[model samples]
Target chain A: MTSALETADNPQDMKRIVIEPLTRVEGHGKVTLLQGSNRSIQQARLHITEFRGFEKFIQGRPYWELPVLVQRLCGICPVSHHLAAAKATDMIVGASELTPTAEKIRRLMHFGQTLQSHALHFFHLCSPDLLFGFDDDIRHRNIVGIIEDSPEIARQGVLLRKYGQEVIRITSGKRIHGTGAIPGGINKSLTQKEIRYLQGDIGQMIAWSQGALELLKKVFFEHYNYHLGFGSIESNMMSMIRADGAFELYHGGLRARDRNGESIFDHNDYRNYDQYIRESVKDWSYMKFPFISALGQENGWYRVGPLARVNNCDFFSTPLAEEARKEFIAIGDGKPVQSTLGYHWARLIELLHCAEAIAELLGDRDLVGKELRNMGNLQSSGTGVIEAPRGTLFHHYEIDELGIVTKASLIVSTTNNNQAMNESIRKVANQYLDGHRLTEALLNQVEVAIRAYDPCLSCATHAIGKMPMELNLCDDDGELIDRLEKRADGRISRTI
Target chain B: MSTDKTFRMDGKAIPFEAGETVMDAALRAGEYIPHLCHNPNFPPHGSCRVCVVDVNGKHMCSCTLEAAEHMEVDNSSDAIIDKRRTLLQMLFVEGNHTCPACEKSGDCQLQAVAYHTRMLSPHFTHFFPKRSIDPSHPDMMFYYNRCILCGLCVRVSRDVDKKSVFAISGRGIDSRLVFNSPSGKLGDSDFSATDEAAKVCPVGAILPKHVGYETPIGQRLYDNKPISVVGDTIAKNHSEKPVVIGGPHE
Candidate 1:
């Protein structure tokens, strides 16, 4: 008697599952898993579908316009690009000698972005799977789901996002591109009364943020088995660490470390990044993977975004942020948890820290009366580096005597973690798909692992639509094997 | 009564609603106000702000301020005139308007308004912006430095004749009027021998680029030949005693 699971000897008995247009992620990608008859994994790949080209478009524009120009790159993290461009130009033009008040206002804007972006990433993007089980109706598993089960958290998300948007509005002079934030300085400063209002809101937000953190810790503890059972691939981590060796979400020296916390490159000299990072684009996708210099894909795997950030920084400046980091490190071997699930926890901790930092900056009296922007002579070249919600971002430019940009280049954060994301999906695919018919939950789990990277495919692709991703399985003779078709309803319509 | 306009002055009723300008309405209602660009013989030119008034929420040149219903208006107020003084100062500093060295110094409407408003000095910093001169035109010279962004040139070029050989470019503070063709030099534009865009320039910005220092300000046609002496007549009196200053439209 032959069992359905016992056909491992037959090569034709393998099953293939394909998940295309993976939803609830920043951009677009696909996950394809191959398994043998006994449900042992054969192969897996996270196929990305975007490319980066904003650097080429920046040439010939006036240097002062870059902050506004780069802001349109991503709606989710425009302020990051704006600040990065302004700082880069400031470095070139010697505008970094800003007053304490100006610096405080800038930090306030940065913290605001951190809070709102993290909330969106957590409640809106990833909560669906954790709250309801994977494959628990994707249509109903969004922020709306949180609103249904926890209306207060949903409202908090809205309020937090509004606070961030308001900071951008007040500081930069507009919420989006805010063409007013120039190289010399900003256009307008925040008033004392406005700071008091922000302080009041911050006081209210603290309780809500604490509750949210508690909820996240509860989720982490409750799902220990699933998280442990999830994919774990040892990879290098990269993020910005502050001057005093603390976690910094905005500006700092980037430290690229191995899985064991051994720093390979610890410097802020971004122009020399090409020597350490190598980017290559695949024909199937627009996203570029930057492997470690002189290393191939298998040996060169690095992760980024929140989990990588927490694993990297020794501690955070604020006491609350530090306590959260301690709680985060205590999970799974005390440091460098190999599972992608920890990204959510790291993000939540950063969110809490951002709120505290914003309140502190708002209370700084210098912020209310200082000059918003400084007037300066245009510089010939500059580079700005800042950490967006996803990871590190770089903007570099060379300008002519008239301040027209002659050259431009950008190193976005998503590119840094491409290899790790691919490997992450493979690890889970190997563990879950080993010789069995693909279950929707396992397939979803594979997608969720890739989502942990929070790859910005829209910025990567420089386009607005999904790419054509094909997934297929065949025997040695190229004859057809088991198959899964991507359906309009976003499920695997299949035959074995 | 049929040719009259109807509106309010400081919330008091008035008449003269048949498309007559707010300045004309105020003048008809015996409201004395200073003006530089409004010539009774010619159509109202709204470039100069000596007749500026605050209506509704915005400040407008009264010569061009269309009387709308229930429009809260403020004229001759210190705040309104202060802003107008700034605008006039911008015009004075932006151009090569050397009042003492100019041909139409004392009798020039621009100089008279400056004297009336008691403009002691250019309040804002001078831009000392660039300009061009065309001395090659047969009967006139065009000085572009003193050209204000009044739409008078655009209107004269399009409305009086069916031709529009001039248009403004680079909006906001960088705005500049350009000739219709690529040659760009005013002498080489498609402007005919009788294009009024040249004459509508209120300041010396568009004076004939040639024939310099010909008529002194007191002897120039605008100064010696006052409108009452020339009669309150239409602007096309080409046969009147010629000042040989230049053709109004070159």
Candidate 2:
């Protein structure tokens, strides 16, 4: 990777800014800003530090272990890896359709995953910034502060996550690295007791999800301009949708839309994702920049995740989330939402959808059926795609006749959003810090832009950590002028 | 009347039948001892010394030592755990046991034991050894990279299956499990999917043909519980149980 500092030219006239080990995110990252004369931002880049060579190392292993093995990529979103790998293995096994019981169980587990992940990002990470001011005391802008100030709201968030985790344990047999979904089908069906256990908490979960949406909506309306314009950029959107153009998470064909909300491609087979999307390797970061092939790299960069899914889909399958989606779209005035902070609103809507979907799936009798697996003959290749909590994820694999994985490729959700994330960071840096004296609060503005996407650097770079961030400002001659650091314990300090 | 001879293990008095090894006695009494190569169905072959326990003042392989009356054993002591952790680190370095990529991860006895010993990191440097995979069998695969040279397959194939299909040929650092057939492939031998040797592997080295992940991960044998609750010997006994996927029983 190119050093973030190297992006600037004319060292005599330019100042170099660097943010090492970006904080409040899942894994390690750094940001670099090259400032021209008069404080004009020349270049900005986000760098991913860790590299997990899961694709290369899985070469000699059996195809069936992909679901279990690939999940080790990210502790925060292992289920996304697990399900995507299972879907790909389903193709390797030559199963065109999973048994009803197996499909429902997998869906339940996925919904549970999405619920817990969104809850964690919103409550534990981002809410502190939204609830308190972004420029508030760094130590007070955390989940602990939320618990101290709003204990009831904090309790609901915790319970909501606990409920999602419980659902995962029931379906997959463990909370984090459960091996429930396999090729063709699941290993065991959910028992009646498990169903009853989740059903008892469904009412409370749904209420809490709605309450979260209300809280975000109220905050957005109160700070309409800032919420709508801060870190905002116009880009394309990509997501998965059912045949009816309804919102789909676990399984569906993919769709891409332009900034005006016109369909670029609707209900396209995800197996052909290579023809539409291309990953560009960069020297400075472990993450690959993915763009739409038709539009080329510059114009092809698009956003994914909750905002993209909500904007691209026709309607949500679940009732409560569908209403929230309508209200969210109305705020866009019949156009695609370009607000970056709007991602938080879109996330809550999806969380509501997940809770309702879980309740709906639990009522189905097939979840407990005996036809859990369809043992089919192995094929040479297979691909699986799903809308993970962050966005669309793809897992592709090729196996030999003996079922050993010969080749593998994965496009995780964070990778899909990589280009857009970098763009957002640059946009924020230019808007907030251009020709202005750098401060700890100004640096946080850059971080707020990145955190809006809730990008899992662990998934993108295939590593793990809480990640402490440091920002350094250098004068035109490249001499250090000032420094700001955010530690993992949520403390911010500055040195000059 | 023959009374069972009892031995103290980790402060608990564990009773053993005549001629029972320390590992067998502990397993039968629902006490777990960390081991890799030893299985209840096969005779103890002290090839992998993962089950080394401190007996009185000296260290001995629990699978090879017979349980004697009133014999005090230190299985969970800090020194023994530290020694086992070092041994595990060596095994990890010696083999390409990439648990993240292996199919037999959650069910692998080596991984569960590592968890039990609180091996947070592979303390030693990784050798990153270059090993070849044998996928010649129609229904099974042999990933040599994950092999710890446990020799369970060699024992099970020879004594129970009577196929004489697997063998170990090398010694010291060059030690490795080898196929006995002329072609050096599992397909060339008379090994069936149902053979006793097929289910005897303690790692991902000898995985069955089509059944890669019959059990999902979290529900797998060791996902929810620690390995200390179920030893390697009992995990082998419950390997055939349909409901229990990877780790030992509750």
Candidate 3:
């Protein structure tokens, strides 16, 4: 594949840029460009490598076990996998018609999972770059950096996240692959004591969340250049819209919208997902791309995640969340604010909103003592859709007469966002690079773009097997001018 | 049996506490309920809705209902037996409950309860959601397929163990057990081999995979001996720990 692009050194060669292992992201992948002699990216590739057959291993198991079974996907968002799996099971049992109490608790838990996972992404995983310096050594760039640099704020973030996990534990039987949520209904009943514990922490969590919001405002306003340096792109966005036409996570219809906030699709039309989205396999990467099905592969550009969600939804149910979305869009709604930089701002807003919602749900006495598992015995197919910390997640399953899972399908958030990230990076790399050397700053910019999605490779690949990643740069003549030698370890070798 | 109307407790005919759970009174009177979910530490969540007993009117969950006076509590009532059978049916339907393939099929509490109630067939439909076996923890195996979702593991971890390692997630029929950490597998979870969550699972779901197949059924739960009689000695001797009468800790 590398031997295809050998070419003469001309103006076109001068315009090309290459980024490898897009930095600061959850998994590994790279992007490359071929200039059209007019300094335009004539050929672009979003290359990914690493594969494991999670779907294959889950085939023989009983359908009811999917919640715990699918949890091995990603360590960062095991709750997302759990939720998706539960939804899949529900589909097998046809349990989508949940009672109001069941719905509320489900939403609360979903919001909690989203909140904690996003908090971990921002404060623990991605924030250090924006706060300290993007080029800081990999060793000094993690949650500990926040602790060492800003102890008070880091502690607040950690505690707030812990509170979310606590809620997950209290509601479900466990924090991660909870057994509380079942095919027919929940396993455990909620109690007044649990409600009290959740209520008591509302004030503390709210304060901490507000502190994060204030910090985001300071960074955005104070460090204009830093914000500008992050990548952006123009693409379509998708998310869940509640029955009342507000932003929702737990159980709702999916909505796809363009940059102008026009609803292109909505109203429980998931069976047509393949029509709107087309997944394609690339040799270089195991993760599949979901392009706009109507426009066809490369032309169809859609994104999923915090940035995409905010762009797609008209309003959030919670007041603070609505306010945050407005503020976020105000920055650059002009052309779908494609820069991955916006992911940070959007994520903080979600974290803030989730905390507030948690407090509200816990304070409601009705929610506290309502029957947890009213519909525990039944057999029907059901569907579950929620916005994971990364983006929108869909779980669909079909069961046999015995209520065993006959088929299972999942549209993970990260996979949906793959194409968008690829397109977004190409745009950013094209706009900024001027046939310059592969500077660390430019490389960091590309990395931040991928990090914005907070993709979880662990969740994407469940089977245990080695998948190799190779990087090759070619010139116009289809000759491999530079090729990274394959080494026993994933590290790129200089021998080639 | 029909003439008695109620069983004698310590030779005094106390009207079974109207809805006063037989298990509660028995425990209150320094007697044991011999049930796993009936944790004296906390109110029973009733995931393992065993401990069924007969009130004057009908059979009910002993943990949830209050005992009433003069209630002819027939713990051995045919109605009580039928209710227990249904409860086990619910348990079996919720997960991949393959008793024959289960490691805990022998010494399993779910199996013991099933035997006590004479559950010949799992009448309810099976929601055999695909399960993941967590052999990740070196010393134990977590067969999520056989989990009854009793919340005992969750309760033990949070209420008694203080680790808060286990939890349940999703809602309605989609619910299943989860771990605290990101990787939902037991390997990545905060649970240790000795964590209370691992220890409290009553079915083959959270079995010590190594020990299940080593024993047989008759010698497994009843062995023709009533649980009340065998349970007393086992409770004092720590039945899980191997011990001959002349052996250490035996």
**Best-matching candidate per TM-score:** 2
The chain A TM-scores for the candidates, taken one by one, are 0.86, 0.95, 0.82
C-alpha displacement of B161 in model 3, angstroms?
Answer: 39
TM-score-better candidate, 1 vs 2: 2
TM-score ranking of the models = 2, 1, 3
Question: TM-score, chain B only, every model?
Answer: 0.70, 0.89, 0.74
lDDT of 1 at B157: 71
Best of the candidates, lDDT: 2
Report the lDDT tens digits of candidate 3 across residue range A187-259.
Answer: 4545788788788887888778777877877877777765755555557777777777776666667787765
lDDT of 1 by residue, B1-250 (tens): 4444466556666566756678777676766456655643346666667688888767778887767556667775778767767777877887667553243443355554555456789887788776654544444555566566665666567656556677778978788877775677655666765665555555555554212232322334445454323322123233353222222432
Clashes of 2: 11
> Candidate 1, which segments miss by more than 4 Å at Cα?
A1-18, A23-27, A32-43, A135-140, A294-301, A332-335, A455-496, B1-250
Tens digits of lDDT, candidate 1, A1-496: 1112212345445555556655423456666555654556655556665444678766744465577667777777788888888787776566756666656677777888778777776666667666676667644655567788888888887787788777776776556645435575655567777777777788667666777788877876787878755766788887788887788866678788777767777755665656666777665456677766744554555777788888888898888888988877876475576677787788888888888888778767777765655545546788787888888887888876645577887877766776677677777666665554545555556656766667353222111111222345554455556555544444345555
User: What is candidate 2's lDDT per residue for A79-152, written digit by digit as tens?
Assistant: 88889999999999989899999999999999999999898878877787788867777667667789899999
Whose lDDT is higher: candidate 2's or candidate 3's?
2
TM-scores, each model vs. reference: 0.65, 0.87, 0.62
True contacts kept of each: 0.00, 0.83, 0.00
RMSD values for the candidates in order, in angstroms, are: 15.4, 5.3, 16.8
Docking class of 2: medium
**After TM-score superposition, what is the CA distance of residue B230 in candidate 3 from its true location, in Å?**
12
Question: Which docking band does candidate 1 fall into?
Answer: incorrect
Give the distance in Å from residue A496's predicted Cα in candidate 1 to where it truly belongs: 11
